[model samples]
Target: MSAASPLRVVCLVPSWTETLIEAGVNVVGRTRYCVHPADRVSTIPVVGGTKDVNWEKVAAQTPDMVVFDQEENTQAMADSCPYPWVATNVTSVQAMPAALEQLAKALNCDALLHMAERYRAALAAPVSRSGRQLPLLSDKHNSSLSVLNDDRPLLYLIWRKPYMTVGTDTFIHSLFTHLGLPLITPGERYPEVDENWLVQHKPVLLCASEPYPFAGKLNAVKDELQLDALLIDGEPLCWYGIRSLRFLESLQSS
Candidate 1:
């Protein structure tokens, strides 16, 4: 398929959905979970969720391309896709600008070029002033909340049942590192932690709002941990792309 001005596309992940919309690409299909910039996807068809999409609905859309992520999507699922697909990986916050550039080229979306530029511009500000040591920044949008200081090692809780937390060397980890916080979990990727583990090794907890929203979901046990806890809007923190650049926060206290 010609990368230039694709007819229509299917987005299998949330960040990819945000990227495609920002790139001004025509997205005919999106997963039910792709809710970023909800105005753009309100009318779009739902193929399925990130892990399991309806191939028949996706094929019927006859999209020129399907965008998936190396992190959020599986290689097996990509192999089964009949349409031409663009796989993007924003491995780190430092690499995100370049990743945006690569995705634009793959989808032939010129609008996305601005996203890369925006990403670079965000990093050049307060982040650079701090000597780029990864000081955790306070959420710019949530101005009411005071800056956190007790950085006893922060934890990003993505799921509940199996108890999965964001692990080292991940995009989320990089974001936190860029913000200047230390992660306590020490596994390769997303690591599962049980209640015993949480109680034993209590870290500053950040419960994600998606992929299993944890705001009200885990409050009971979150209080039991007896550690500073906050609800992290997962989008700007974990989701890589234009949205992250826009949500680049300022540090109130490091």
Candidate 2:
């Protein structure tokens, strides 16, 4: 008796693309937005973007599995998958491990679990410290978690030009909630807020590097809001996968 070989896959989610590549799986196609592992991603065939997936191109690849992020890919695309497909819904920082685990099991890949373990270990240690002390967000310490010790109110922005911000429904919101930070939103997803609003609330503002470039243009915010503004990498705050592990590692040194 012979077992079937591993399935060829197509990943519509950027995070899933990295995770599958890290697990040493054969990912035959990816959406245009799957740009992580920048050097290698370009060589892979592009099916389409998440919002406008090319089902015909994906079908031509004959991939055994098509992985899409629930939030990134439209439901219409998921319905069009002729082959076996999996939808990843890693919407919160806390759901990453479970999400990876499920995807691994779905594909019968043990390497994916190993990658998840690496992520868990990476987050559980301070890269410079004894490699045991967990930082702001840790699943290890439950009862006496230190994330709640700080009440530093902060607002994270994801977009500009009308000024959309982090809301309770987003992974970024969960990240701050785990860190016990006071997060304020305009009571709606992607609600518009201005500098005057920042002046009134007076919280540290973090400008993300994607969706809209916020650097150099925020000098006025620094002066007008009278607050500390940091332009940060948006991937860790948004994507919940291998890049996130790397992000946590960087935070250790920063």
The candidate that achieves the highest TM-score relative to the unseen native structure: 1
Error of 2 at 245 (Å): 1.6
TM-score of each: 0.82, 0.80
- Per-residue CA lDDT of model 2 for 123-231, tens digit only, reads 5664442212222222221223222233545677677666678777777777656544536887655677787877678665666767676655566555655666566
Q: lDDT of each structure?
A: 0.72, 0.70
lDDT of 1 by residue, 26-122 (tens): 8899998888788889989999988888899997898988888887788988999888888877678888888878777877766777778877877
Q: How accurate is candidate 2 locally (lDDT)?
A: 0.70
Which pairs clash in model 1?
134-180, 135-179, 135-180, 136-179, 136-180
Q: In order, how many clashes per candidate?
A: 5, 0
